[model samples]
Target: MTSLTIPSPGGRLASTVVAMAVRQRAVIGDEVTYVVLDRQWQVVEPVEAYLEYLRQEQYSLNTVRLYAQGLASWWSMLEDGGLDWSRVKVDDLARFKRRLRDRGIDSTVITLRPEQTAASSTVDVGLSSVLGFYRYHAIVTGVPAARQFYEHVMGGTMEARSRYASFLGHLGGGQDRRVIGRRREPKGPPPFLTPQQMKVIKDDAGRLERGTGWCGDLRLRLFWTLLEETGLRLAEALLLRHRDWQPGTGTTAFVEVQPLEDGRRRLRAKNQQHRRVYISDELDDLYGEYLFLLVELGVDVQDDLPVFVNLYRGEFGRPLRPETIYDWIEGFKRRHPLLPSRWTPHWFRHTHATALLLAGVPEHVVQRRLGHRDIHTLMTTYAHVTEDAAMRAAADWKALVARWGATA
Candidate 1:
């Protein structure tokens, strides 16, 4: 990766004028952790402390990366305004939100639409991260300003009642405190690919030719099929091992989604939860074909080895990096103008869940299949679809009432 060096402006806070950056480090036992760095490349003690707290609390690496970025942005804002972090107030946070809306961290980023500002979702995430940092400090170090950022209320109070509901309803009618609220983003339907688009991409990846077997990269074909059929995350699919797949002749096969200690990279399934995802017979056959091709290429068929490896690249037996898959997707986007411009592998997952729900599958079953920790998450994510279903039911009721009135 190319590094950009910015000349520090002449100021008392020059040591952090370039703001702060998150740096990754390997701790004891080879576990990777992140820390924030100042312009002088020194570790920011307070930020590191917060990140270490998250690590101890078993937050995933992805979560840590996000929190680290938010803290870094906060640090940069402080540096620009020559304000002390300990003295941050609600007003300062509000100003920071405007700054994010106007220019973001780096305005130099290329975009076709220049009028568009930072997305509300992105701003909300950053705000949440920053607030989380202060909340941590307030509880652990008793920072006065940070403590003042929150106010406690009795559970019976309207404020407390409004804040706690749904899954958190149990906490209502008890002593509760409210933190700073994030910007509310507009809800929309989950983005998914159409069946035709799915077929086009799958064919583009690996198409079987007449008189010949599979013509293109059979491994990628299998990988695409696995993602399309199983709704596995890119990381989960890339981290899959040969033993995870259980194939049977003319019967349904299953793949186990479990965390494993991978030396190539430390990618894990979301929440590191273990679940079995069943695959179609065609997908199982695809897996078998890929395995056969691997053996033909003299690749060892070790059960513990990763199912996807860098076959064409010089690093023959190394596990495929997540970047490799992303690069391939970018290539597909370039070649297929008809495909969604912002298409991603995760689209397959959304499509999978949407298809299931539209087919009259139970919400709880879809929740389990998607490995959602709670039904609420699945419901909230696909609320648009559920709401439409409800409207359809109401329409049916209206039609029945009309028929009864005519009969009467």
Candidate 2:
């Protein structure tokens, strides 16, 4: 048997806690809990260690929750197969994949999670989490079989490599070496709005009013206007303060997306990176009018005031929630029977990416504007845009070559 070693006090402590906790669980008869986790997101063996590792790695709570659920699904499969997780062979992992595909979905059996009818994407996430669990244990808990198992599962041996530009480098932490990541090809381009659908949605937004009332709410208009123009993640827009607007940056205006670190519903961009978003001058003027409207409604027009706020009954000054914005969009969809059932507020983001690509904006520029960590992400998400862009590029090259060939 080969031995594994890690030279870190924190790593050893985490392993010890996880190992002891599971053994104690047998004596305690389930009284020994592994943190207060949602049923579907519960971890099995090494729960504390894995969770602690994620905490140390600075994964967000929401990110931790999804990762936990994926691990929980893997554990459930292991229990059904009656196999020890630590001793998992490649064949066992292959069998798990086959089982998931064969079962498809057992609605009655899968109650805790949404895997009842989960797509291929969900299955892939589960597989990734299981692999990650093995790799982590192999490194931190000194389990040699785990290293062998990780290689077998990967179907290839991994090479150690240097990784510069670490996120926690400033704190003198974060891994300087990382396993080469393996992400399966995306299942498909996400459902997005077409130019026609966007035009329709925009027209509808322009005409929105308070339910059953003749009065037009400027807040309602500004909310949709900001979302459409800036392509903000709903939470980013929801938590926007008046001070975020940095007007007059040489014929354009920019808004700063600040983090909502200390709130019940914490708000951050998907990347958790601060970004500057430019909006049309029209939107800038509209915001000015919206601020005046807020003042008229006896709401404070201060820098700290939320751009979108609850203005009904007792909840008047509270910042609006993403869900509330979604609800309003849903209501709009219902009222306009012509609206596509597949349309969601997020389609605006997709549409924005598509429109930018179609209009010949450089992908990197669009990527930066949208706060995408990778330009490849935008290219993948808007494959249709890229395809068209590719064709146009080919045509331009062909014309240039034809002129040169004729002269030669």
Candidate 3:
């Protein structure tokens, strides 16, 4: 549908079929299968092209899957409503937004999460994805109508017209931008484990008896420690390899974070950059112990093997999945009365970033440590820290003012 055709000398039926075994997987883990297209390139055909475009741009698989789903869902909605793709208007886009905002969304359309609220935050997410799909087609094929709908309706720009114009298609990428800050209330800072709670949890994890058959509590602790110390994303830490870690001067080490680039098995880093994190000897030793446990369990200690693997779950040597840790953490919170029910692996990242900033680490340094591309991103998350610091400074100023008045 997006115009990838290899014309054959033997006519249409004699075309060679490209084996999919060697086809690149979508940056999204699960890529979509190609659908047969009609002579016209409208409707769903562009969806395939748009997905491939995402993969080419190195968009993550999760991102690609969302675009694919959003587009396909919108396409189905269009077909059912007897609407023409080329003829879609700004008002139609509003209708789609309302439909997504309504309760009782068809399970087939979207699988809602507990955290997903109706009408605003979650609905905006869907609208963004769907709008992205249209943007993809507009940018790719330079479709004027699609671009107009995206800019006018979705971007909150001017509306589409009734009569056709003999003008050029979507001319500029900057013509439209996503409308933001319209939420009823902005989200609060990410939750984090308190220092006291972290210690208690670490003690509980440290006291894990390998004999109880969970041999991986120490491994979990190591994972958590890496998050706390390094501020590495959970996925980055999970996909770590033995070779990725480097030993440094007395009681110190560094963990290399690389874009594992090629395989679906070892996905690329979220930020897709190569960086290293300093590690303490204590954590390095914990890592060694975890490795030794893996060896004791007859798991291979190859340099390229994933650092974290299933220890008790029947799938033994397979890389430990996030869901496993999520469930484990949930159960852990249940077992230990001190741990917060809302605490998660990601919270460690927030906790680490906050700790570093409040400890007087420079913003640029914290940004690099957290693998954030922009210092503004770091500033945005920790803005509350800045405000608190300012408030404390104001108190000092007040004290100085009082002293000056007394002297006067």
Which candidate number has the best lDDT?
Answer: 1
What does candidate 2's lDDT look like per residue over 1-408, in tens digits? Answer: 112234576655322221111111111342212232222324344755775677566555555555566665566556555667688877677666654554434333645655443456565655665676776776678688886887665555434522212222211222322232323555666555554565456555554356743145567767766765666776778778889987655756778987553234445456677888877666777777777767777887678877888775337877776667667678778877786786777777765665565555677877887788887877777777567655444223333223211111
lDDT of 1 by residue, 256-317 (tens): 88865443365767867888887766778788889999999989889988899988874898
Q: Which scores better on TM-score, 2 or 3?
A: 3
Query: If both were scored by TM-score, which would come out higher, candidate 1 or candidate 2?
Result: 1
**Clashes in each model (backbone N, CA, C under 3 Å)?**
0, 0, 2
**Candidate 3 per-residue C-alpha lDDT over 265-346 given as tens digits, one digit per residue, 9 for 90 to 100:** 4345797888867766667777877877887889988889888888878488887777787787777788986667777778
* Candidate of highest TM-score: 1
**Which parts of model 1 are misplaced by more than 4 Å?**
1-30, 104-116, 152-181, 249-251, 260-266, 386-408
| Model 3 ranges off by over 4 Å | 1-43, 103-119, 154-184, 208-216, 249-251, 261-268, 389-408
In candidate 3, how many Å is residue 250 off? 4.6
* 2 versus 3: better lDDT goes to: 3
TM-score rank order? 1, 3, 2
The better-scoring model by TM-score among 1 and 3 is: 1
Each model's lDDT comes to 0.70, 0.59, 0.62
TM per model? Answer: 0.78, 0.68, 0.73
Please rank every candidate by lDDT, starting with the best: 1, 3, 2
